[model samples]
Target: MPLHRLLYTSEARLSDNASGADLMVESIVAHSQANNEKRGLTGALLYVRGTFIQALEGPLDALENTFERICHDFRHARLTLVDMSPASERMFERWSMTYLAQNDEPARLLVNRDLEELYFTVSTNAAEAMRQMRGLLLGEGKKPALEVV
Candidate 1:
């Protein structure tokens, strides 16, 4: 039987700070990709300047269940979920997930810039979108992150 898939997208506003932003971003990207490789899930992360616009697609249940842990994760502030939909096309082919930053600079000095205002004004749904992604991965018998405890 073929597994059901879901595509989730999110935008978030975070507290402005130079410390931890870079490391958190790197860790999240690395973590997602690693998890994907282990589970064969596909996803991607995009950061514009200091804002996050991510897309994740995978099995239905695990993706949705992850939100419970994400909301608890609280690594960042003002997380918001913007889009959740079933994707007809897979954005990433092999990698469990791919991360892209929209910062004008691709290197450390540029990509490492700590301009938090870019996202602070944005909506807060990153966490919610993350939860949705988890549900997609886990599939069925899934509860919203808010219900997870």
Candidate 2:
């Protein structure tokens, strides 16, 4: 079956506190992993400077339902669907939901480069940007340590 990918960026409504952010990340990962695994979905989620950039891949109905839940999620605000299209294959096949807490220079640089253009304009290079974002999240040769609830 053909895969579908949904990439979105959203402003986080929670306060930026060390413990709070950590707890929120844990909660999100735990919840997402359970749901995505059950639905046979896969994705990566990145949180940086009170912003969330996520890419989810799966069947069309599952992806759409997941996006709908995200749209109504209280933790997110100003949620923008950055890109949605048919994907030839899954970019994150191993992870049900990988959570990356952006704290490094490379992630910062990539986010700076892409988020502005992605959030403001309808760029034809959105797919490339999404690919780059996925790379930045998963490229460091180290998988993010997602806490199991």
Candidate 3:
């Protein structure tokens, strides 16, 4: 089956408290893992500064269905589809749905820029989004010097 990757960003509607955010992330991870596994999908979700940046890869139909459900989810707002295209391979193949919290170094690095700037970057540059996501998953430990476009 042909594979595709869909990347997106959304403003989180849940409380920003650490505990509340943790709970929400945990719930999302659990639910995503179960559903994605069943559908042969893989992805990663990063929550930072009241926003979520995520990338999911799977069959085109499955990715579209999953994205539709996300669009209707009440837990977030301002859903923006960043990039969607055919992918040669899955970038997050090992994870059904990996979760990264705000405090993580990579997540912190990604949100260091203003929210608007970050969204603009992702929306305009798919390569940069892939770079950031790969860096985070690979535990690069250093913040990428992403140029604001």
lDDT of each: 0.50, 0.75, 0.77
**Candidate 1 structure quality by residue, lDDT tens digits, 69-101:** 554555534456555556555544544766544
TM-score of each: 0.54, 0.77, 0.80
- By lDDT, the candidates rank as 3, 2, 1
- Model 1: ten consecutive residues of lowest lDDT: 140-149
lDDT for 29 (candidate 3): 85
After TM-score superposition, the amount by which residue 48's alpha carbon in candidate 1 deviates from its true location, in angstroms, is: 2.3
- Using lDDT as the measure, the top candidate is 3
Candidate 3 lDDT, tens digit per residue, 1-149? Answer: 99999989899888568788678878888999999999989998876667898899999999999999999999879998888999898888878988765454564555444333544567679767766776656556655444211
Error of 2 at 1 (Å): 2.7
Give the range where candidate 2 is weakest over 10 consecutive residues by summed lDDT: 140-149
Our model 1 lands, by Cα RMSD against the true structure, at 12.0
Misplaced by over 4 Å in model 3 are: 104-120, 140-149
